[model samples]
Target: MTLLSIAGGIVDDSALSSMASNASTRKTFIDSSITIGGPYNFHGLDLDWEFSSTTTDMSNLVFRSLSYPAEAMENNLDWITVMAFDIGAPTWKPNLTEAPAALYNPFSEVSGDSEISSWIRAGFPARKIVFGLPYYGYAWKLKDANNHGFLAPANGADITADGALGYTHIRNRIIGQGGAITAFNYTFASDYCYNGTTWVGYDDVKSILAKILYAKGKGLLGYFTWRVGLDDNWTLSKTV
Candidate 1:
C-alpha cells in the first residue's frame, strides 16, 4: 500500500532515516527509477537507480542493488524497483537531441534483461521488482546547436509546456491543437507543429502503450514514472 519512490538529486541519510523512523505512520516509499549513482542514505534506506546511461549494463546494475540487500533489510525495505526505461530506447537522453549510433533497441538486448532478472531472482523476491516505463521521448536537433556535440534539445515538438506534457497529454494536445501526428521508422513515434521556425520531437500514445505492454510481458511487478507532475491531467497514475 505504501511505496517509497527514489530519484536523482542530492538526498541525505537524515531524510531517509526520518522516513523510516515514522514508517508506520508516514507510509513513505522510495522511487528509484531515475537514480544515476548512489547508495545514498535516507535513514539507512538503500539508494535506487535514477536515469542511467545507455552504457550501463543491466547485469551490473542489478548486482549493485543486490550488494545492499542487507542494508535494505535493516531499513525494512523489502522491495526494489529495477529502473528499466533506458532499456527501451537506448539512445534516449533527456538533455541531448541526437542519439549515438552505439545506442540500440534495448528490447533486443537479451543479456541486459537477463542480467536484471537474474539479479532480482538472486537478491529480491519477484514481487519486489518494479519495472519503469517512460512517458516521454528524446528529441534531437536536426542541426547542430551551441557545439554541444550530440546534446539533444529538451523541449521538442510536444505540447502543453516544454517537458511538461506526458505522452498522453501530448497526443491529446496535438489533436486539440490541430497538429499533424506522424510516426518515424527510426524514432518510433513523433508529433510536430509548425511554429514558423523549427520542428520538435516527442513520443505519442502508441509509444507509451508499447512500453506499458512490454513491461507487462517482462513479468515486472509494476510500472512507475519519472515524476507524476510531468503527466498531463494526472494520466500517469491512471495508466498505472
Candidate 2:
C-alpha cells in the first residue's frame, strides 16, 4: 500500500480540487494503502514542550478535519501525521534516567509521550493517526562555568550548499564528512558525534524505530517523516 500523507497546507479549496484532479488523472496510482496526512510543527505551538503540545493539537485537529465532509477533507485521505521529537533538553534538563519535566507543567508530571497519547485518544481515530519519527536529535551544550547553555536545532544545523559551517551548520558537516556517530541511552533517544572539539547530537535508525513501535502500540496508523530524502542511507526506512 502507498500511503500518501498530504501536507496540511494542501487543504485549501484550490488545492483540494487540484488534488482530486490529480487523483483522477493518475491511473498507475493505487488508491489502496493511500492516506492523506496533515502537518504539525513542534516549533509552532504554545505548549511547554513544542513536541508534545503540537502532537496533542494535531491529533485533535486531524480527527475533526477527517470527520468533516469530503469537500473539506478529501475522502481518499485516511490518516494524519503528528510530528514528534526525541529531545527534552530545550524544555527540561537532559536526564538520562528520569523523564524531563514539562515547561508549562500541564497535567503536572506527565511525560511527553503520555501527554501525546492521551490527547490522541481523546478524539482522533487511533487507527488513523500516524506518528512522525524524527531522524535527528538536538545537541545542547552542557552548562559551562559561565552558566550558559546552547541548543542544537532539531533539524540538524543548517548547512550551506558549499558546506560552510554556521552555528547550525556544524552537525551536517560532521555527518557529511563521515564522522563516527555514537548513541547514548538517555530519557530521550539521542545520538552524538565528536568533531575533535564540539559534541553534536541527533537521531538515527534505532531511535526512529522505537518511535514507530510506540505509535503502533498506541494503535496509531503508522509513521511519517518531515521529508524522506535526508535519510539518504535508507536506514530509517529499512527500520520502518
Candidate 3:
C-alpha cells in the first residue's frame, strides 16, 4: 500500500534542536503531530531536520529519553536512508572540478562506497540501509574550456551561484542547447557532461543504474533519490 507521510523541516535545524531538547516539549510535539495527522489520514511523519551536528543535538534527536541506540534502531526502525552524495562541491574544493557523488575515490575517503562502509562498520545493518542518489548535479566553470576533465582547473561555479542544476535543466539547457559532451568516468563510477566552460557532474541513467546495482550487490535495503521533481520527464526515475 502507498503510505502518505508528512515531512517537516527547513534549511536549518535549530527548531528541531530546540524541540528535541526538552522531554515535555518533545512529547507535546509528538502528540500534536498525531492530532494533526489523524484528520489528514497521514500514515507517517518524516523529520527532515537537515542535520543535527553537535553531541547534544544528536543526543536529543529521536526522543532523548530513549536514545536511538543501535539495538533499539535495529528493532524499531525498518530502515535508514544514507545520504551518499554532495561529496565534492565548489565550496569544498573551489580550485578543481570534482564529482559531487563519486561511487569510489582514490584520493580520499569521501565517496559513496566509503560512506556506506563506514556506516556498516559503525553497527548499522547493511540490509537496513537505503543508499541515496542525487537527481541533481553541480556545475563548475572551467578555467580553460580546452582543459575539461576530472580534476580540471575551475574558476568556480557556473550558471547558478551554487552551481546546482536539476536533471531537466542539464538535459534541456546544457545538453540540448549547448550539445554538451557527456562521458561516464568508470574510475569514479560517475557521469558528467560539459559544453565549453560549463561542466556538470551528476548521475545520468547510466550512473543511476550502476549505483542501484551496486546497492543490490552490497546487500542494501534499496536506493532513493534526494528529490523527484528534478527528473527530466521521469527519465532518471524510470531508470531507477
Candidate 4:
C-alpha cells in the first residue's frame, strides 16, 4: 500500500495545534489531503508530528479526552510501530561508548526490551506492536585501541557520517578493509568492531536475527528497518 508520510517541522506545531483544537479545521485539512491523494491511489496517511509537549495537544490529535487516551489508540489505529533504535550515541553522550540500538541493557532500563515493556504497561497490545531495527550505526574514536568495548572510554564521535555510518559503509570501509575485529554481544544483542582507534557499533546479521527472534518470542506483529537502502547488499533485509 502507498502511504503518504507527512513530516512536520517545529514551526508546524502551532498549525497542528490549531487544527486539532478545531473540529472544522481538522476535517478540512484531512479532506483536502484525501482529495490530493485520491489521484495518486494512496491507501493511507502517516503523520510524523515530531513533538507534542502538552497532554491537550496529544488528546486533540487522537480525538480523545485525557481519561480515555488508550481507548482512542485501540480504536483509531491498526497498530503501532516502536522505534527501538537510537537509544544512545556518542553525539548525545560522548564520555563513553554506547550501543546505538541495544536490545537489553543489564545495568539500566534504557533498552528496547524496557521500552516495549513500558508500552505494554501503557495499554498497547503486543500483537499490535511492530519492532524496529536499524540499518545504521554510530562511530566513535576510541581513546585507546585496547579499550574498545561497550562503555569504553572514547575520544568522541568519529569522522565517518559525523559519528553515524550506514551498514554498507561500515561493512565496506571497516569490516571489509581487513583486520577489523568483529564481536557480537549476546547479552545486549548488538555488534561492534574496532580497527585501531576507530570503533563502530551497529547491528549485523547475527544481531538482527537475535532481535527478530526476540520480537517473535514477545508476540509482536513483525519488525521493520529504518531504511532499506542502508543494508549491506541487502544482507540485513534478507536476514529479516
The candidate maximizing lDDT is 4
Query: TM-score, each model?
Result: 0.46, 0.47, 0.90, 0.90
**What is residue 163's positional error in candidate 2, in angstroms?**
13
TM-score of 1: 0.46
Candidate order by decreasing TM-score:
3, 4, 2, 1
Collision pairs in model 2: 6-37, 136-203, 137-202, 137-203, 157-168, 158-168
Q: Which stretches of candidate 1 lie over 4 Å from their true place?
A: 4-7, 10-77, 86-125, 144-169, 172-176, 184-203, 234-237
Cα lDDT over the full model 3 = 0.83
Candidate 4 lDDT over residue span 1-240, tens digit each: 567767543357887788878789989989988988888999878676766667888777874544435556877887777788888788786768888899999977898999888877878788988898999999999999999989999988996545989999999989998999999988888999999999999999988999999999999999878789999888999899
The positional error of residue 171 in candidate 2, measured at the CA in angstroms, is: 9.2
Q: Rate the local accuracy (lDDT) of all candidates.
A: 0.42, 0.42, 0.83, 0.85
Per-residue lDDT for 51-101 in model 2, tens only? 212333333333233223322233435554555543253324342211122
- Decide which is better by lDDT, 2 or 4: 4
Alpha-carbon deviation at 170 in model 3, angstroms: 0.2
Worst 10 residues of 3 by lDDT: 1-10
Worst 10 residues of 2 by lDDT: 95-104
Give the runs in model 2 whose Cα sits over 4 Å from its true position.
Answer: 1-77, 86-112, 137-181
Off by over 4 Å in 4: 8-21, 63-68
Q: Rank order by lDDT, top first?
A: 4, 3, 1, 2
